[model samples]
Target: MSLYRPHKKGTTPSGYRGTVVARERDFTAPTVQLLNPAGVLRPTPEAEPYLPLVEALPDTTLEQFYRDMAISRRIDIAGANLQRQGQLALWVPSHGQEAAQVGSARAARAQDHIFPSYREHIVGMIRGLDPVNILSLLRGATLGGWNPAENGNFHLYTLVLASQTLHATGYAMGIQFDGSVGTGDPETDAAVLVYYGDGSTSQGDANEALVFASSYQTPQVFFIQNNQWAISVPVSRQSRSPLSLRGSGFGMPGVRIDGNDVLVSYAVTRQSLEEARSGAGPSLIEAVTYRMGAHTTADDPTKYRTDAEVAYWAERDPITRYRTWLEGRGASPAFFDEVDAEAADVAADLRRRALSLTAPTREKIFAHVYSEPHPLMAEELAWLDAYESGFEGGAA
Candidate 1:
């Protein structure tokens, strides 16, 4: 017999359900989903107001959203395969969160600055950074690739949990000081979007960043992609209520959205970002998505999570649902075939680029840390050189 009692057919699973704000057509309750899982373009009560924005998107842009999400998923899968094949030192998979990443990323305008919390590969790609730029880091070729200023204002990936939140806040403050926010010029005025995970919310740096953002009224959005797992720790163990409520305590508005629905993600993020840019202060978004894979190539999800949980999320696959909606809207099979072909080409290119990457030299690590020579660094370099000289393959 099953240990747990099953809920009704339309209700969410026990642990995943939140306070019902409003019911959808299917009678389920949880985060906001503009498009239902069945691929119908049904807007929830919270998302109804944004229907015009969603409808305003040109057909080409809507198609691009699907293409971008498809390509990103391919890139993520390729990254994992490369790691398993020993081509990459480690890989962070954003498997089921493509809708969350791509939707919010596509919402940003060119002048908007983005700060990513390591796994936002799709976001980085949307901001014009080469996908290989991220792979190069995982391949141990460089600390980071692509200059943020030149590469569409997308910052380097921050692996240290929640540290990027502070960096993003500081940058947003600078944007404010420079009279960028609320300038009434969309082209010149800028806002910042920073991503972190649910686990990062518990970090002091993230809370501190929120305090500063609220205090200074910085034009920014703190996007928390609550993927339900902090390494091996479930979000239920970390917080009592929704992660979104944490921002409200800091005087910033917070909204929890169904991260699996691309439409809601795009609309909400676009709305939040616009509010921030217009000097309405910062906003927080808790995207309720599932990781759908091991946290990284080094992790083993089977050890902590159950197969049933995985299967549950699998049924709500963002790509498949979006494809259904697109088809219902008269999207041709030829278009999907073309997207598939493009995804294949992107995967091939990524594989080629990843394999081509060369590991950084030992001495190169000593550079970039300090602007001027320091005694401790010099001594360390000397020690490294002397230590290496003892090996048969030591460099001169």
Candidate 2:
């Protein structure tokens, strides 16, 4: 089970010896929540200002959020199955965190650059990535070979934790230096949206990124999907307080929100990204959600997690919770049925394609190690060929 505690009022900030005026999301209110676990539209008072943004969204955009979550859940299940069937080396599950990903990805504009952690398959899809491309990485066919510029600027995933934070901050700084931000032009102003996880917050890279982003006031958003557990380690074991508070400690706004509520995720991220692109500097968002599955296909959640905890989070499953809200908003049953059918088709297609994926030639490894041909690569290629030819029955 995950151990999470909301930051209480008047709790003096600790650890820092400097003049620390803690600027938490709220002194009393809990995380930002709009939809209850039961799919009821009970917005927290702190979320009132963002309701207008949600209300202004077109019907199609709103429904697309639910569709994305549903499809993501399906793709996650398929990926896990593929790993179990020995088609892939590993699979990262993103089941319970769909709302957080879908909402945040949709919030970013086309010109915005997105730096993602490895588990953000849904986010990549939202940014125009083919889901099959994600499977290719686990299958060892390529090293995240997708071109970001051609794929809605969705950068390749970084399996190394928290490194993307620095990459994103640097990119945001470049945007600032290039005069691409705060131009009052909605279409051209670009910001950076980077996703990391709870565990990454403990990394030096993440902290350094936050420091640089704040010092430069970079056009970036540091999105932390606090999924309660970083692998088997409960979040409580990682830090003494809420992760969002790190924003204030770094001179930026920190927000904790109900990550299971797609609406809250969308609204909060949308506003934060707009603030970033407008040159208001960077902010942090900690989405308090749950990881309803193992950390990866190589993990066994039954070893550390509890059934009751899983049940509790399952009750608030992002896809179903958002579906209930969509239904309440007069979304027709036909639309939901269509979404389910499409999800199945997508999963089936991925499975077929994944199975058909052939192993790349040995030479494939030497193809793109360098942007330009290097003497070292040529030497290594020659050695590899000679070594292979020396094997029994091998060609000269």
Task: Write one digit per residue (lDDT tens) for candidate 2, span 1-396.
Answer: 645554445453442345556676433326998888898888999888888888899999998998898899999989999999999999999989999999999999999999999999999999999888889999999998599999999999899899999999999999999999999899999999999999999999999999999999999999999998889999877777888889999999999999999999999999999999998999999999999999998888899989999999999898888888888989999999999999999999999999998888888879888899899999998999999899997756
Q: Estimated TM-score per prediction?
A: 0.89, 0.91
> To one decimal, what is the Cα RMSD in angstroms of model 2 from the true structure?
7.9
Worst 10 residues of 2 by lDDT: 8-17
Highest TM-score model number: 2
Positional deviation of residue 31's Cα in model 1 after best superposition, in angstroms: 2.0
Report, for every candidate in turn, its global Cα lDDT versus the true structure. 0.90, 0.91
Can you tell me which runs of candidate 2 are displaced by over 4 Å? 1-29, 390-396
- Colliding residue pairs in candidate 1: none
Model 1 lDDT tens row, 1-396: 988787776576665655677744332224777888888898878788878888899989889889988998898889999999999899999999988998899889899999999999888888888889889888888888879998889999998899999999999999999999897898888899999999999999999999999999999999999999999999977787888888778998888898998888899999999998899999999999999999999999999999999999998888999999999999999999999999989999989988987777777878868999888888898899998988998876
